[model samples]
Target: MNMHNTSSPVTSKPEELVPSRYALKIGDIDVMVVSDGVLPLPTAMLAHNVDPSARAAWLKEMFLPPDAFDWALNAVVVRSGSQTILVDAGLGFDPDLHLPRAGQLIKRLEAAGIDLSSVTDVVLTHMHMDHVGGLLVDGVKERLRKDLRIHVAAAEVKFWDAPDFSHVSMPPGFPDALRSAAKRFVKEYGSQLRQFDEEHEVAPGVVVRRTGGHTPGHSVVRVASGGDRLMFAGDAVFAVGFEHPEWYNGFEHDPEEAARVRVQLFKELVETKGLLVATHLPFPSVGRVAADGDAFRWVPVFWDY
Candidate 1:
């Protein structure tokens, strides 16, 4: 877990807060791990199925604080030839949210010398605010990019679009805001929206596979070229999810389904030895999931690049 330090051009009293971004190669595609910021959640908000005491003990064993966990808001950028594809834009600019560490994705992308308009495709893993928020400009309803095609799970769009569809897993009264966001997203990008039902290819080397349960149509993106392969596992597994695929987060729409998908995806990754780019493992979350007995472990990539 030797995370690389990608510097931020800002200063503070003790030390400068650095924003992280990393680049790696997946066959012919050039992939960049960009950060939006870190989202901290109380440990009490984590486990929905497991006993609280047991979960807390495990956290303590891992040398983590008994109170909170810092989850990274990471997004991926994939470039092949002339095409630039973005996976799950981070939390958009929202001053009201008061999440100081989040909402830095666009700034990090710009700092990396990536042109905002050059992004040709936006492949949304799910319609979570943390993921799709960056699609809109700072506090504005307008889209950040007008020409890029937006791809999302058909099931996801249908689930969020239904008037009667109430999200049970979110905090009380939060579902309304989420539903409104989804509708706004649809209204803004419906003309450019491309929805897929099952495993479908977005580009020559990029494929989206449905791994539902986190959301109705949550997906994992697979990018393959030559003999190299990489999996952009969007919200399928967090760092702890690797060791306890059976234990699901409170936000999981269907905990059982999410666990099932996690186990299956982890096994497949172990068998294939594919590089995993997770959204919430650690900052610049690129790693490999290996079988640890019946469970799994995250062996993060150690490249300095």
Candidate 2:
């Protein structure tokens, strides 16, 4: 399978770095940011949590698409020695969903030299559709391997799997699906599924940071090798200028907290000068955060495939 170079600013397909796929090396670990598909929200839907005037002004300046915002779905796969770890599973090939660019993750993994059977662990930062949709495959359940262990934050588990989650005012048709998916995973993983708190080590050279607020337990991935670092900022920021440290999606479950978490994450990125990966910020979705005056901008790592 082939992928369009979502990271290419030149508007042409990029060269294949993994020979047959997409894999970037930081040091000892191989990081592959794979696509799940795209999720398009009507312009009206995005205006949910922000003031209409502010939203209007921002859209006009950015020259956004007609009547909608397209969010790219992606997940990161990390390989260390023989350990294969998947950051998040994307939306599987769901034909019913006409996301022109959706559901191609497993194929991308294959191109990157990763086999689903080889994945030992799957870490879910949250239960959002874009992040968790790839968990469930056709005949098999959400299990990556026969015994793949699924890891998630305890709060994340509680939020989606909770019986009373319906009481909360979420997007019109989302609460039901979220709850349904949570239950399905619970049944599939059984004892192989587990949960952690705020910060914990999910795998070698990987630390899970609980950067909540987007959802109850939204988290981010921090990876380090030979003292070099990379932060996989999940659904924390939108691609079109959400790089201003505090600029975050209004859909965030806890907007104020999301802003605080993004600022803190940006601070860490600045101090470390580490590579950064954003799930929704374009494709080949890895870049660096740099201070532009008081705000921040994403400097895409062009060298990465």
**Highest TM-score, which number?**
1
lDDT of 1 at 44: 58
Deviation (Å) of 7 in candidate 1? 9.2
What digit string (tens of lDDT, one per residue) describes model 1 on residues 1-305?
A: 11123344554562325646787777778888888888777675467567889889889888888888778888998886777899998877556555687878877777777767778888999987788888775543243567778888899988786733332344444466566667777887788988999877888899887888888889989999888989988888877787788887766777788889889999999999999988887877778888899899999888664
| lDDT string, candidate 2, 159-179, tens digits | 765544322344455665656
Q: Which regions of candidate 2 deviate over 4 angstroms?
A: 1-21, 44-47, 93-100, 163-171, 240-250
User: What TM-score, over all chains together, does every model reach?
Assistant: 0.89, 0.83
